[model samples]
Structures are given as structure tokens and as C-alpha cells.
Target: MTGSLETFLSTAEVHDAVFSLRPDYRAMLVVADGFDAGPSDAASEDALQAGEAAARAALRDRPVTEVPHVAAWREAYRAFGAKPQRTRNSLEAMMRRAEAGLPRINRLTDLYNAVSVLHQVPVGGEDLDRYRGAPRLVRATGEEPFDTVADGAAVVEHPEVGEVVWCDEAGVTCRRWNWRQATRTQLSEATTSALFILDALGPMSDEALDAATDDLTDRLTRLGPDVSVSSRLLAQ
Candidate 1:
């Protein structure tokens, strides 16, 4: 599937408006194929457990808002007119749930979610095969359709005008930045090839983001033999 890999290399675009909104923003796009994919196994379970421990250590006795990276995401959310409290970023939401427990979605999703919490970054994984075009980050015009599940049924929603979102030619893949992912492209047990997005802001250094990326790559490599992975760093 050289063509598939090339599609990922098409250079994901970050709209000028999005960059202007937060000059410190950066994203790491990771694509992996030929790896074993299925429901959460022992390896993923252990990773989730370790990630939970790391999150607890980071939180210690502090509130989620006090975490530096989380605070940065909160500020980013506010910059786009989103209420951080009412609609939390993925990173903040994961950390808050760490005390209770993170969900065991699937091997790919679980591992990425663990890496997200372990390194204090917001990581989103999607079925690469489901994507129709190169991913792009932009300020939504409130017209893009976002397919999602609500109340145990399928539904379509739109983002508020001027909100930050990740989308493809199909529609919005993620809404309100990293707050939520669309069901249309979400990872599942049947997925063998996947795309992972690691979101970061000013508070997280390049080194920190790389560490998280490395951690994820390493874990994915160990899942099975012949796992091929590629990554690209998107920044201003």
C-alpha cells in the first residue's frame, strides 16, 4: 500500500487562521500499518495501567487546571471562544478520568490513549482507511458536518463558527479542536492501518512531544512483527 502511505505524506495543512490563533501549536502525525490490531490485550492493559499511574503522579494533589500543559490547552480552547470548563480538551479529559480509569477501546486506540496520558498530550487515533483526503486543521465555518453517535443512535452535528477543528474532504473528523472525535473515522478492532494525531501547545516542549511520539512508536512496534510506521511534525 505505497499509495496509502503516500497519501499520509501529502502534507497535512494547518490553516493560516489556526496558526495565527496559536503560534505555538504543533502536531505530530503518525501512520502505522501491517501491525496486529484487535481488542485490548494484556500489553494494552498494562500500558493503560502504567499511564494511569503516570497521570496520578503528574496530578498528585493538584487540580486538572493546574497542570501546565492542560492549562495551555484550556487557554487555546478559550482563544477559539470555547468554554474550557464546559468542553474540555482531550488531554484534560483523559487526565481527569485517569483517577477513575481510562476506557479500553481497542488495541490501537487503547495504546494511543495510554500514550496520550503518559506524556500529557492529546492523542487522537483514527482508521486511516476511512479518511477520504489529507487531514487539515482549520477554523470551522459552522457548516461542516460531524458524524457522531448520541443517545445510542447516529447523528450529525456542526461546529460553532470560528472553532478550531480537524477535518478532511469528507467533513469534520474532530470538533472543537481535540475535544471530540467523529464516529465515522474512529479506530476499531478491524483496523490494520491507522493514523494517530498528537496535539501540543506552548507548555509542552519539542522534547516532551518527541518523547510521547517515541513512546507511542515503540509500543506500536512491539505489538507485532513487520509493523511499519511513519511520522511527520506539523508546526508553524
Candidate 2:
């Protein structure tokens, strides 16, 4: 696997640790890209509804609890074009809720939601074209710095130093303040090809991560014949 794949795989270890510490907690990772339509369009209402149904069925009798963070995520998106105060407040509120353990909900949100409900853990997805290369999954190291995207929206910077980050060649991509965008790259309807990373944190069983990765790969591959999918475990 390449260095990038390795980084994502390392998240499985983190998953394991988290499970060991909090056995009642579960986590999942889901990634999809290269659909006939981009994530924005490919993740249609029908798709999300179907995904949510699948997720509900999966968690029907599980001991798992959900921390839905997608709703807050969507709210952030809705606030994206609003005034600065409203935007910042909305995003910050969503961040706090996510930190407090809320499962996010979105059209594209259902994909991760299904996995999270089934696995009984947290799951997140971001548009790769919207991320900087080599994004890090770490916390803010210093004062929050940010850059504007081609859309003219600002991303909050607060990567915790020494913590794992989904960092790109440019800087942090999707984690914390910037849950789903990078200043350098942004997903658009015009996006035809892309990369995706499914990151997990804490001590998780290899079998589990593999299963998740396999399932994700299978579904995404069917989305397009030219779609390229790869997986790896990142070493801390």
C-alpha cells in the first residue's frame, strides 16, 4: 500500500484501542468516490433513504448506540453561504455537537450513517477532490489559521499537534474545524475522478476494518468501471 493508504489503515489500530477502552462503543469507516455523479449528486435522496433503511435494519437488535453527526454537518453546509456570524456559529455548534457524540445526517450522510449504526460507532466521509493532498487527522497545533476555497468560504484550522491528521501536501483537509473541505481542492459537479480515505481511530480488530473496507470497495466499484479503489493501514 502507498503511504496514504497506510495512514488510513493505522486508524484501525485507533479503533481497536477505543473499543478496548469503551467496549460498548463501536466505530466504522466508509468512503465512496468516482460515481457517475460526484458525491454531491451521486448521493441522491433515494440513495440516502435506501442507505438509512439498510442502516436501521443492521442496527435493529444491536447493543450499539448512535451519535448522529450528519444533521449538524448539513446545518453547517446550509450556514455556509449565510452571513459570517451565522456561519461561524452554526459550524461551531455543529462541531460541539459532534464532539459530544452526535451522528451526522446528510444525503451523502446515509452512507456513513448506515455503517455507523451497524457498527455502533462514529463514521465520517469527505470529498477527496475537496481535500488537500495528504490530509492529516490531527488536532490544532497553534492558533487556528484558515484559507478560503475557490467558493470563497473559509475553513477553520485547529489541528492538534502530534495528533493524527488527514493532512494533504498543502495542509489539513477533513477533520475537526474543517470536517469536509480543503482550501486547495474542492469537489464540483464537474469532478469525474477522485480518491477517498476511510479513517478509523482507536483499537479496532483487523477483521472488522477489512470487512468495512471490502464492503465499501465493492459498492463503490459498481458505481463505475473506471473507479480505482485501494486500502491500507497507516502506521503511527
Candidate 3:
């Protein structure tokens, strides 16, 4: 847990007070350099499809809710007045979309989206360059700004009070845990620096989380030449 990402998390005062991830909570942080988030290639597209197949297989006999670990995400969402059915966590959302097939975005995004569905974890990435000051997971006061694209226009919105969010001095970087990402820190084809977060809760073991991170690391490290990777487990 070092670099701009670590600095971002440590500089926030309200992080631990609001988001004391339970003793069984676990998050795998992957910070990388030399990332080329260029357009998706043939191989990347294939991998995404394969991951979608796996997701479909996982849901063939059971719904996402019965997945067990997803129950923790549902509880967390309800704590903030969000209905998990209406505002699905990243993993559930990806699983739904993956049932048919996943849309190929880019090499970086495609890889993570695939992994999220495959492992059923909430995985998200941020363009580290767009972050301002430090980032923290805190309960929103309902006044801090959040920049996002609404419809086809850029809009500034405020998060609901008690909503858990990832924020910095500028604005909210991610809202409702892993539900949405801000445009400010969006990864693009030209992005070279990136930070990825993997969330897991009770009923999910550390060994499973480690396996997911290892897979993610292996694929990302080969994203481009000279890519350097570092990872840490952020948990209780």
C-alpha cells in the first residue's frame, strides 16, 4: 500500500471512521506502471468472452444473490438506503451483462470486467493521474461534488447522505462503493498509470481473493512492455 494511491487513502481523516471494513473484509490493491489502456485486441476480446461464459455458468443454477458473498454487498448497499436490486454492485451488474456477453471496452477495462464476473468480486480501476489530493472511503455529507455523465451531458451531482464513496479534494471518484466511477479518473487508451481495487467480504476467503489478484496481475503485467506491477492486501 504505497504510491499516490496509498497517499490518497492515508490522507483522508474520515476513512476508517466510516469504512472500517469488518474483520473478515479484504481488498486487493494493484498499482501498476507502463499501462497502455489501448483499444481492445483480438486476444483481449476473446478473454472477455471466456469470462462471460464463466459468469453464465456460475449463474446457471442460482441467482447472484444466492452466490453467498454477494449478500454482504447487498447489506452494505442497504445501509446507505440503496436497494441492491435497483443499484447493483459492480459484480452483480457485470454478471447480468455477462449472461449474454460483455461489451469490449479496452484492454485494461476488459480484463478487469472479465475478472470481476469470473471471481464475483467488486473490481474497479482509476486513472491515477486524474486524482487530486488524497482519496478516502467515507460517508458522503451530500454536499461534496460528483462529476459524471448524465444522459449525454456532463453533470455535477451530490451523493446522498450516508452514502459510502471514494473521494478526494476535487470530488467523488467512485460512488456507492463500486457502483459507479467518475469521469475525472476514467481510464483511456492513453492511460499509463492505473490503480485497481478488488473488494471481498465475509464468506469469501483470503485464498480465493489472492487467486483473483494473481490472475489479474499476470494478465495486466503483460499489458505492455516494461509494465511494472505491485500489489497489497488492504484489509482488517
Which one is best on lDDT? 1
TM-score of 2: 0.51
Predicted candidate 2 versus true structure: per-residue lDDT over 1-236, tens digit per residue: 22443344344323233233323323333334446533433444444445445454544564112223333333333332323233332223332333234333433444444444334333445555555444344333544344545356654655444322345545655433334444444444454434444434333455666676675566566666766555554433
Off by over 4 Å in 2: 1-35, 39-47, 54-123, 126-132, 147-164, 177-186, 201-204
Ranking by lDDT: 1, 3, 2
lDDT of each: 0.91, 0.42, 0.80
Q: Which stretches of candidate 1 lie over 4 Å from their true place?
A: 1-7
Query: How well does each candidate superpose onto the true structure, as a TM-score?
Result: 0.97, 0.51, 0.91
* Worst window of 10 by summed lDDT in candidate 1: 1-10
* TM-score top scorer: 1
Q: Pick the winner on TM-score between candidates 2 and 3.
A: 3
Q: For residues 1-236, what per-residue lDDT tens digits would candidate 1 score against the true structure?
A: 33666567566889899999999999899999989898999999999999999999988989989999999999999999999999999999999999999998899989998999999999998888888788999999999999999999999999999999999999999998899999999988988888899999998999999999999999989877989888989999
Worst 10 residues of 2 by lDDT: 63-72
Stretches of candidate 3 off by over 4 Å are 1-14, 20-23
lDDT (10s digit) by residue, model 3, range 175-221: 98889999999888888888788888887788889988998898888
